[model samples]
Target: MALCPISLSLPTLQYFYSEMRGVDQENEVNRILGAFKLNPYEQLGLRFDCDASALRRQYRRSSLMVHPDKCPHPRAKDAFEILGAALKHLEDPERKSNLDNALSFAKEELLKDWRKATKHDAGVRLAASLDARGMEGVEAAHVATPAFAEAWKARSREVLGRAEWRRRRMSKRIKEEEERGREEHRLEKQLNKNIVEHEKAWEKGRTERVGTWRDFVAKKAKKSKGGPVGGIKPPKRLRALLRCYQQLSKARLSLLVTATASAGYVAGSREQIDWVGLGWTTLGTFMAASCANTLNQVYEISNDALMKRTAARPLPSGRLSRPHALAFAAIAGVGGIWILAGKTNALAAELGAANIALYAGVYTPLKVLSVANTWVGAVVGAVPPLMGWAAAAGSLDLGALILALGVYFWQMPHFMALAWLWRADYAAGGYRMLSLVDPAGLRTARVAFRNSCYLFPLGLAAAWLGVTSPYFAYESGIVTGGLMLCAAKFVSSRSTANARLLLYSSLVYLPCFMLAFLAHRKPNDVDDRLELVMGHLRSLGLFRSGVDREDEGEEREEDQGRVAAGTSGSDGAQSIAPTPGASRPLPPLSPPILTGDFWAGPMVGGLPPRGAKS
Candidate 1:
């Protein structure tokens, strides 16, 4: 039977009551257990050797038996509370260690004191028996012998108890180390299993993700196949045709020609536009530009291969043969001039052919030979607008020249900036540019600035020549002044940044100034001629009845004075109100300029001189 801690001492019961007396009796058993003081393992009905789980199991059994509701004993609640506290104390490593230390110290002290008392008692008994058995004369000698025997017996028992305690401790330590090793091996196997499971999960997820990506690609390909390019492979001939077309066109630069041509057509024609003629002119210009561009590429293929900038072009990259390129150029060049001559006018056709000749024949070879190539290239670029103007009017005129000169001046800063940026490339390609030749950029900067200076006078000349309104003089002054300022900055700095500013200013000035000139063009001459015709018609009606037209005109001198006073400012006002009694009773509408006929009529054969013919 196990010795119960409670049964060992009646003082223990009293001590337990004393500890529990101050604690709240009305509290739950667990709370009471937390405050309770008792031997934890003993309260749980476990030996000190029991493991944590055994302690816990014994605690549960004891708690169930001593529970206040089930046992119905006065001490049952206390027992349950104590049992809960014991379980907690034993479960906590720190509290359990303190309890074990106290128990061990108490056991050690008790054993030491018992050894002293036993030695004293054994010495007294042995001495008394020795005194009874020995002769009276040997008492002193026997005294030391009995004492030594008792001390030896007491020391032997102490040594045996210490050896037993040490043996149990060593056994416990070995069992604990073996248990720890088994636990570590179990954990190692578990970790390996977990790692394998994680890898499997990762691979599965990766496979799913890859499958999803493949599905997306397949869906995209299917969708794309149903759309343009259609899944079917293009024929070799068709591919070659497309590749050749792209290489020959140089679409972006051709658009500039188309734009200037449109501007020129607007500036040249006073009557309604001829859309069919304009279309032919644009198409002709595009073909001319395309032909020139292809020829230039063909001629420069070897040089292009030397420059990084041009090395990837179709010709230099060997994507298209020279024979194919030459054939395309010949066909486009001849075809473009023929279209212009047949559909537009001889002057436009000649300008288109000249533009091609200058760009390909003169400018292309000139690039390698001389820096003057830039000037020739600018002249070439300026021809498109002239072509358009010629196409519209069937001849070159002041307006056409003005438009062309504006384009010519605009390219100076534009090309100079580009040349400065690509000077090294141009050097590698053996092209002579001002940027490369001057090195200091002084000449290039001066050229750009000088052209900007010329642009202002050119703009004013356009206004003075009656190509645009006087407002254009003022507006163009500001625009040109800004461009000149940018050029001046480039001249002073000779920096790429300043050059870029000048270049961008040129780009902005060209289109804006062209549009401004087009927007504010002088009102059609047809208006004044139409007014003269209307006046003549009114005079004819008076002539039919033999009325004196001269006297009627003289009578309206006072009315004319009043109208002139009202209209005589620099406002460009036109007066169409007839002198009083000069015509029929119909009130004059605004001048023929206001009527749509000034702008919307079919092309006039030619303007008749005033008073020359109806």
Candidate 2:
């Protein structure tokens, strides 16, 4: 048949054309949202029980693929609009419930049909034929038609298809999540690298500026040398003074001294702590350390000038005169000892004085004479804790000795590695360090390893002495084992790399050990004794109970007045108040006197008698 061309421009034809386009668009929307082709579960790429967050995540991911801006396909805009509408439909309670009910009804219908088909006469005949294996009977009864065969086949396909679909969905989701995590990790690493580079650049610029300034000042000093003033005219008076103080005090080392002192105070104080006394002890230790350091600089001025490491020190650099250094040392030394003796105790003061003498008098001179100076320096390092202990306890005890020994053992590995690192400097300065004298480094490595081994027992000793809990022993053991491993490595290789490793380990080990010790510090024998005495006093009405103080305040005043009157007499014995009309007089009472120093004195099962010496 011959066909005529239809004009789409006509009103009736245009209307028909628009209607066709609308129908086509509706079909595309249905295909994209899977309204008829897929279940709600498959549409959202999730199981029925998926949570809201998972639903949102999957919906957003699908939307991204269909987004008009990203896809720019003719179908994508329709797909995305339809996906948004479907998400809204699923999100609504009534619409979602209706969809779920319809799905469930369909499944029930399928299952009912499957169940009914199994019970039909045709199924019975089929089963009988298959069982008998009679080809003639099977062919007559339609042997290919088994019981619920189509339903079972359809159900199997559904089961396998659902599982495969979910498997693919989950595998793809996992891969995408992992990729996201890796990208985030890469970005984080890049950010950290940028920060580190910034810090490095800042440090480099600062170091260059400092070097340039130093060179400028040095050149100026050299130019001034030929003038009336000497070659090393000091900088501005205040600047020179500050530099001298920093060099003379050896401020970097003072931190270690202070930390050890604080640790010792914590270990030694059993009953109670006197914060004021601890402050005094720390200040005294720092002052004494500063004084000793000043004396050491004075003694090694020439040697220091020879070594690159020590060339910029106060005396060697001529920033301060010898007389000024001596004056600072004398003042600091005397002031430190006085603070200890007056504020703390005689023993602490004695230890501080001894440390100063040992470090300057013995360690300093012996550095030139013998390699044994390192041992003396270790002794000096050990005494600060003893000073702290004596400051708090007013006596040296087993715990104090153990702490001192720990410090002593710790310094051997610490200094041996340091000596190895700086052996050339020591040789240039004519100082006889073990690393410089023992050319093979065998003895130095052995000593370091041996001392590290000693720390194992040292940590255990703190626990055994009841200064710390048993956990400290385990913690300290692990850290000490690490140090020992480093020491052994240095011994085997005798290389600078191994030596640096040992140095780093020792530095890490000391603070960790100190922290463990502090964490595990327990109440010791003194605390028990003090508690006992306080309980006895409370029972005897000599001390007030802490509870119900508002009610007992008047009674406490009356008791204090009575005790005061009883002690007013010249004789040591005072009469106790007797009951009214009692025939027998109360026995004479000898009450003990309470003083500020009483708690620090010896315990006697109770408070000591009045007038008894501590």
Candidate 3:
């Protein structure tokens, strides 16, 4: 990733045609020139007078070239990176020499590749030069041009190809040998089967003889014996989901579109997930959301109990066991992928897994550890829509990213106001938010105002790029920006009243913006924003809007009841009504539970919530 420019900032004759990938342009060219190795303008391929005019002229051309994104060659890209890093280093006068030193090192490496290539060519030409030396003399025998270098490279290629072939063949032989050993072991097991069978037969005969002798003896000696041993039956909970939920955070689950929901409008109004293509993305989103919500419970259950607003939650209320909570998480996490795999494509499944991992693995823990978690959570929240986009498009869509980023950036103002309102509770609960940082709400208010202000530029880009319609642009600008301004001027700067207004505005802004974005019915627009939204809605059926348990319980119960009644053919079988939170009543008491030594199946049913990595 280091892109310090050296002499070979441009494609060095060495790796230019062979290795250049992201580093192929002036973007890198200018970057390399500025950051990597520049003692003076003259040194960086410039002829500037020691004046501002010449320096500005050079800066313009340089800037155009090393724009990073503009680069066409792999080396150019590398150079651009180097240039940027170097610039950052040079920005501090104290660090300029350090950057220069690093650039020098990078340039050396680039030159090394180039010179070695040239040297190899020179060595190969020694033979031809010798032949010429015999025919004409030292003067006529010399080869100075790039032709000699090509000859050397050709020979090198031929030699390397042979070596690669030999290596591959050796690798194959080694693998085959290992496979043969495994096969022999399998054959050995087959051969031992007969011996084991003979031993079983012998044991059976011996047991029969012993029983007969013992019975004969016991007829005269024994009178009575104890009947049976029994123990109280333990109450059963759904183990699979529990186990899955426990193990869920690490497993590959399907896409759950739950993250965007908490985001309120953003979740709803954002483009649709292609149910057919990106269902797993929805699964991931759900896993992330579920994980975030759950982790909040895990870390703040005690704190939540102290708060009147949160005391009714499963954990705080003691309605849900921690193990059960863990298990539920596991189930939801892995089940995400399981459901998605069957319903959508492979990519969706992977995205779901990734989302769970990020949310559960990274974001969750961060809540207990640092304030940065909110930002990280925001990032996790944004990924679901992207996943939705990818699922529908079968590729990455910029529109999805634009929408996601708009939401991500918007979180600052959106959450700051919330943080301010709940600062006291958050501090009491040990939750870090902007309000916690600034108890008076000054800093939190400012951040909300600032982020709301940024929505204009971000929203404008989305509008101009056709990610959404002009309607969204105007609406979002008025809603987000206006609210933020109000909070800053009236609420943020004054007592908490206006701050509350700002927070309310933010809550309103998010959902309203998303709704407006969704409402944009631009006939001429090429993006399938509406189509994707409709598709996901169709897949989710009528309940897409409300995934809350209260809303879903009845529907789930009905479906399970229908399936159970149809399947329960025997009248004598005992059954329990739906377990708490389960779709239906527990299965009849006859079936054996899959657990301990008797339990055998896949370790997990589906993908778990994504763990955080980046």
- Best-fitting candidate, scored by lDDT: 2
TM-scores of the candidates are: 0.49, 0.49, 0.40
**Per-model tally of clashing residue pairs:** 0, 0, 65
* TM-score: model 2 vs. ground truth: 0.49
Winner on TM-score between 1 and 3 is 1
Work out candidate 2's RMSD over C-alphas. Answer: 22.2
TM-score of 1: 0.49
Instruction: For candidate 2, write residues 474-570 as lDDT tens digits.
Output: 9989999999999999999899999999999999998998899888887546545344455545545455322223233454467678778787867
- C-alpha RMSD (angstroms) for model 1: 35.7
Q: Which residue runs does candidate 3 get wrong by more than 4 Å?
A: 1-288, 490-494, 521-614
Off by over 4 Å in 1: 1-232, 235-244, 523-614
Model 1, span 445-501: residue lDDT tens: 999999988889877777666778778888888899999999999999999899888
Predicted candidate 3 versus true structure: per-residue lDDT over 1-614, tens digit per residue = 46666654765756665445334343346445443133333223332113446554555565556554664554655554554443354346675554344434544454456456656576545654677454234223332334533443344344445555787999998997787677546544643563465456647777777798697567535533432212212223345445434332323222224534223222223344233333344544566456545654665566565555666666655556688776666665567667655654566557667766777678766764677887887787666666554444445554566668767767776676666666655554545555544545666666666666767775676666556667777787777666767766744264667766766676677667666765662322234553344333334432122122223446557868866875685875555445554433222221112211122122234322123112
Model 3, residue 181: distance off in Å is 68
lDDT (C-alpha, whole model) for all candidates: 0.72, 0.74, 0.53
